[model samples]
Target: MKKMLVFSMLILVLILGACSKKEDASNHGSVNDGEAPSEFGSIDHGVDENKVGFNLTGGTIEEAANVPAEEKDLIIRSFDTYIHAFNNQDLDEYMSTLSEKPKSFNLDEEREYIESVFDEYELSREAKDITIVKFDEETGESQVFANLVTKMKQKSTGLETKRDGRQVTVFSKEGGDWKVNSVYYMEDQK
Candidate 1:
């Protein structure tokens, strides 16, 4: 008799569980519904799993007007130039990607420090999984994340090595150009 009662309760619980509505994973808002979400939330608040960072503009969501094509191109080009300069060991070009004087971050890191590392090795980088974490169109402040595979060869012996890493850089539009405000390197890739 007790077993029969327990079995009936189990069936009732299963039915109730099945009838519950599926909760949205992305901040309880509708995303990917072929419409601009009623509200846009920052990463700290909660990111829409689908929208994630920025659908940005003219992509799948078709809202490129916010970021603008030219602004987007500038940031992307700046990052590309940074990568190209590093791979070629062009310190001047690489430094050009940094924020202007009085903007520390890499700037205050000192040229001798960078040159010391540069003098020790020949380096190249492979970047993937690049994404914009956040962007404020009005202020032109943004954050971008990416995974990097860096290959470094000892200058003296020519022994090459590679490391997997991730990075997030805060960028700001100064003088209508995107410049690195700061950089945060993440842990080694698993």
Candidate 2:
């Protein structure tokens, strides 16, 4: 049952990933309303999908917040810290929100992927709708899924882009603190 929920959430993210990007006025395939981003020599892989930008926050509903902090509360806090730190380009601080060793869709590749995002663009992210897809009390394993809308601007060219997708992060306890064990993202527009 638990495995099924996780799988289902993964599929959900993929299908909903491009939902946000379609709203942009310039997103009709233009990089920046006609001007190209300045060449900082950043790798413009020309791919539309963002490999990073998973986001979540404290549940606004009182009933959701009423639960024990260890389960849902901690997950929210950790994720909030992650998004803020990443947007701030504080790699060390951002990495701290993750487990000492974390995994993404790829093994040990999260750091590299996030670094690329930080290096190339100035980013801001929002969690549109958050849902706890699954939680396991015994193992302190929790999966949070959310619709994410993120705007990014190339550092040099100032070319702005938006991506809408579904994001999922799995949290687990490490030294009594909630830390991200893994993160997955599905971008719809790309």
Candidate 3:
């Protein structure tokens, strides 16, 4: 009888051990176990569907803060408008936000850049957890950062592709308005 009891106890221990291992595997980087990572990885290619072009040369927050309040607001509003335009794929509205003559770069140049980015990264199917990294209200300039979640469509097996881990965007103020200046995409090593 004692031997049978010992055998039963051992069996129970093995079952518990197996269950715990499964639990740990599922718990790996989970919402309940810890802070949920941004879903940018699930998106198609981490492309900002609405992204146009960013000013890659804009400096740090201190420099952006030098912009006047009124100009800053205009810049922020312009950026917001640009985001909307890109998501909606409204070419006319997107163009309107840009400078009339394109002192630094022409509209065509901007469009080509945007197209290249989209073709390359191909931002996720949905956008979420958008956080503004730094916005200097005093300067009216801001660094807007957001996570884009992308996923592979099961139906499109032939078009398999990797996902973008995270995407960062910088906006700058020029000619009393804000425009997307640069987009930095971080890839997952794994």
Q: Can you list the residue pairs that collide in candidate 2?
A: 17-164, 17-165, 17-188, 18-188, 18-189, 37-157, 38-157
Listed in order, each prediction's TM-score against the native is 0.60, 0.59, 0.40
User: Per-residue lDDT for 1-61 in model 3, tens only?
Assistant: 9999999999999998986653444233334445343222111223433342232222232
**Model 1, range 1-190, lDDT digits (tens) per residue?**
9999999999999999997656544432223323332110111223223323432221332223356667777777777786787788787887777777322233534444456658888888887766666668886676666677888888999899877765555578889888876554533645
Q: Rank the candidates by lDDT, best first.
A: 2, 1, 3
Question: Residue 43 in candidate 3 has what lDDT?
Answer: 16
Candidate lDDT (C-alpha), each: 0.60, 0.61, 0.49
Q: Pick the candidate with the highest lDDT.
A: 2
lDDT of 3 at 119: 43
Off by over 4 Å in 2: 1-70, 105-109
Q: What is the lDDT of residue 29 in candidate 2?
A: 26
- What's the lDDT for candidate 2? 0.61
Candidate 1 runs further than 4 Å off: 1-66, 101-108
lDDT score for candidate 1 against the true structure: 0.60
